[model samples]
Target: MKLYPIESGNFKLDGGAMFGVVPKTIWNRTNPADANNQIDMAARCLLIEDGKKLILIDTGMGNKQSDKFFGYYAMWGDHSIDKSLAKYGFNRDDITDVFLTHLHFDHVGGAIQWNKDRTGYETAFKNAHFWTNDNHWEWATQPNAREKASFLTENIMPMQESGQLKFIERPQGDFKENSELGFGILFADGHTEKQMLPHLKFMGKTFVYMADLLPTAGHIPLPYVMGYDTRPLLTIDEKAKFLNAAADNNYHLILGHDAHNEIITVQHTEKGVRLKDVLTWSDVLTGY
Candidate 1:
């Protein structure tokens, strides 16, 4: 199996919102903010070439939203989903599966795109089976007040409408119990209900997609939770548990929104699981 780091693009978000109650003095050290107090974050996605299946982990925010809507996020950078795929000698049509970590606009926006004539939406990856959980589908489709803005119908409805949407097996227990994914799926509720974090076993190393659960290395500390998370206290508990397990097992965590750090490992320290080592995707995947 081969893995490719597909950078969708970059966008700006309020640093305070991204780091929750964590003081600016702390998070700003790593993710320095602009004059407007917005931090630049990468909408990084992953592509997996496994046998006959070409699976893409999260699609970045597509260029379909109106200028007024996009004015809020301040999208930047030249790395687009198409350019990244072409860099790896592939195209959207080559993707066989689109495994969405969640239905948030930034994560799944690139999953659908405007049609040729711009009449309506269509599946971005025409050949891929867009994967999302049944429960998440319902939650996103009928979103609550706090999350309604993040779950855009334009980005989601088209996948199902195109007949390319499929749900991974979900059982009685936590979603992970029933997740016999090619890699593995770690269900995290602190950020959003049943956000799927893909764990990949590659090159004798475990590479985990640290979705919004751990957006960046700066969030390694238990208390550096995102204000957007519905359950902040629960996030604390979840982070502690996951960080410990990640440290103990020496897993390589791939950050979802980190613009710099790609992969890192944690070690047990006096303060907690502090970052032990940092490496790039090439280093871990191809030993470059």
Candidate 2:
């Protein structure tokens, strides 16, 4: 099995929103905000090449939204989905599965794209089976007031409409048993209902897709939950449990939004599970 870090692009978000009640004095040390008070975030996705399947974890914000809508996020950087795929000698059609962590615009936006002549939407990965949980599919389709803005129909419905949407049934307990898709799934509800973090066992090592549950290394602390989360208190509990498991198992955590740190391992430090060592995906996977 081979894994590639596919960087779609970077965008700016309000630092305060990204780091909940965590004071700017603290988070700013790592993720500094611009004059407009927005911190830079990478729309990093993961690609897995396991035998016949080429699975993509998430698609970064696609270039389909109107300029007015995009102005709010201030998208930046040159890295794009196409460019990233080409770096590995592949393209959109090469993807066999698109495992979405959730339906948030940034996470799934690049799953669909505008058709030629710009009349309607189309699946970005013509051959991929887009995977999302049934509960999340329902929740995103009928979003609550707080999260409605993030669940854009243009970025979602097309996958189902194209007859390529699939879901993993909700797990009965804290963790699902025998739920490995060549990579295991870890469900966390604090960020959003049924956000599936993929735990990949590669080369006898475990690498986890941190997703929004741990957006960056700066979010390693239990209290650094994002304000955008629907359930902040629950997030605290979830983080404590997941981080403990990651440390205990010596898992390599791949951050979803950390622009600098791609992969990191945590240790039982004087200040909780502090980052032990930082490495890139290639460095860890290929022994570079």
Candidate 3:
């Protein structure tokens, strides 16, 4: 199996929201904010090439929203899912499965796009089966007040409407091993209900797609949770358990939102689990 890190684009978000209760004095040292107090974040996606399957994890925010709607996020950069796919000598039609970690706009917006006539939306990946869990599908479709804004209808409903949406049976416990995608599914609730983090076994090693569960290496600290998380206290416990296992097993973390840093391995430190090494995509392909 081959894995490619797809660069979708970058956007700005309030550093305070990204760092949760962690004070600026602390988080700023790691992720400095701009004059407007927003930190840069990448909508990096992952592409998996295995035999007859080409699965994409997350599609980044698409370019369908109005300028006024996008003005709030302060998006920048020329990278996009289409351009990134072309870089690998592929196209949207080449994807067979789209595994969404969650339904947040930044993560799933590109799953659908405006049709040629501009009359309505259509599945962006025409040949793909969109995968999400039953619990998250319900949670996202019937979003609570706090998360409603992030779960836009245009970014979601079209997949189901297009008859391409499929739900993974909610796992009874922590994860389901070697499911359809040939990986373990780690369910995280602190960030959002039943958010699935793929535990992929590739190149004879384990690589966990660290969605919002661990947005960046800077978020390795247990206390550095995101304010956007519906349950911050629960996030602390989740991070502690996941980080410990990640450190013990030496699993490489594939960061989804970190703009500058790519892959990282964590180690148990005196303070807590800390980044052991920052790795590049090439380093992953070449080994160690």
Q: Please give the range of 10 consecutive residues that has the lowest summed lDDT in model 3.
A: 170-179
lDDT of 2: 0.90
Model 3 clash pairs are none
1-288: candidate 1 lDDT, tens digit per residue: 888899998889999999999999999998899999999898999998988888999998989999998899888879998999999999999988999999999999999999999999999988888888888899899999999999999999999999999997764554353233477787878888888888888888888888898998888889999999988998899899889999999998988799888888999999889999889976885665
Best by TM-score: 3
Report the candidate with higher TM-score, 2 versus 3. Answer: 3
For candidate 2, write residues 1-288 as lDDT tens digits. Answer: 998999999988999999999999999998898999998899999999988899999999989999998899898889999999999999999999999999999999999999998999999999989999898999999999999999999999999999999888777875663343576788989989889998888778888998899998888889999999999999999998888878899888999799889999898877887788889876885775
Considering only N, C-alpha and C atoms within 3 Å, which residue pairs clash in candidate 1? none
Per-residue lDDT of 131-218 in model 3, one digit per residue for the tens? 9988898999999999999999999999999899998887678888845787788999999998889888888889999999999888
Error of 1 at 60 (Å): 0.7
- Spell out the clash pairs found in candidate 2: none
Q: Give the TM-score (vs. native) of candidate 3.
A: 0.98
Off by over 4 Å in 2: 177-180, 286-288
Evaluated at residue 238, the lDDT of candidate 3 is 91
TM-score of each: 0.96, 0.97, 0.98
